[model samples]
Target: MALTWIRTHDWDAGTWRNRSACRDTDPELFFPIGATGTALDQISAAKSICAQCTVTRECLEFALATNQEAGVWGATTEEERRKLRKSWLADEQAAAG
Candidate 1:
């Protein structure tokens, strides 16, 4: 899939949030304390929901754009997003150049 970069100025475009699969779910499920045992379970559960979400890309883009340091967005864990954010930033820079 092609990456779509979202600007901070467009953070207000949150209409897709209402259409998210985890909207009604527990917010804590997405924000785990660690990446082991129970946290892993939480991540798995959150990802399952994301897997079924139509606005997952939008959610992930928002997380990446806003630099969300925690939680599972777009089916990715905190560590996962951190690595992806680096690549995302590189890609954005390259695109801008």
Candidate 2:
């Protein structure tokens, strides 16, 4: 049971398999990483693709639940979520201790 849409978006979603999407591989392809701005630009490109995805909500939930500390999930970048998760973990540890 394979979801075609998910597979198609797999490349744009920055999945481990998609790391090369922006990088040309074929001997015939000659693309350049010439986007304006800084690293935010890369995140923006990935987010733009995720925005139109049908499974954005599901992706977001999975990311938060698994404490995913990498990649962009939903509209949130890994760095942004990392700070939030770190704060939550610290609070939980303090409460438990």
Candidate 3:
């Protein structure tokens, strides 16, 4: 037997990527190197940039929809994103039920 699964998202809507405030910043800022204080600072800095982004909502939606497991996105760190995803799933389940 053969089994396969596919993943998809509104890539066309990802036009926001072209305007991302972090686009010109060091990509490393979005990906903290560890759980140390320096890493937390990096995450904070990345999020600050996201705070000023006009496309922040789009960036967040895309990150959530894609279940991004790493890096800062839309002013949220990995742990924060995890919590948001959990809450979002709970909301979806409640709505569906």
The C-alpha RMSD in Å for every predicted model, in order, reads: 2.3, 10.8, 8.6
The lDDT of model 1 is 0.84
Lowest-scoring 10 consecutive residues by lDDT in candidate 1?
A: 1-10
Please tell me which model should have the higher TM-score, number 1 or number 3. 1
- Give the best candidate by TM-score: 1
* lDDT for residue 77 in candidate 1, whole number 0-100: 81
The model with the greater lDDT, 1 or 2, is: 1
Residues 1-97, candidate 2: write the lDDT tens digits: 1111222323335554333232333312111133345555666767766666665654654565567766667556766667655654565456558
Off by over 4 Å in 2: 1-38, 83-97
Pick the lDDT winner.
1
lDDT of 1 by residue, 1-97 (tens): 3566554546548688889999999999999899899999999999999999988878887888789898999888878888888888888788678
Error in Å for residue 80 of model 3? 0.5
Worst 10 residues of 3 by lDDT: 1-10
Ranking by TM-score: 1, 3, 2
Per-residue lDDT for 1-97 in model 3, tens only?
1111112345336478999899999999999988689998998899899988987767776777788889998787778878788766665566568
TM-score of each: 0.86, 0.46, 0.78
Better of 1 and 2 by TM-score: 1
Clashing pairs for predicted structure model 1, backbone only:
none
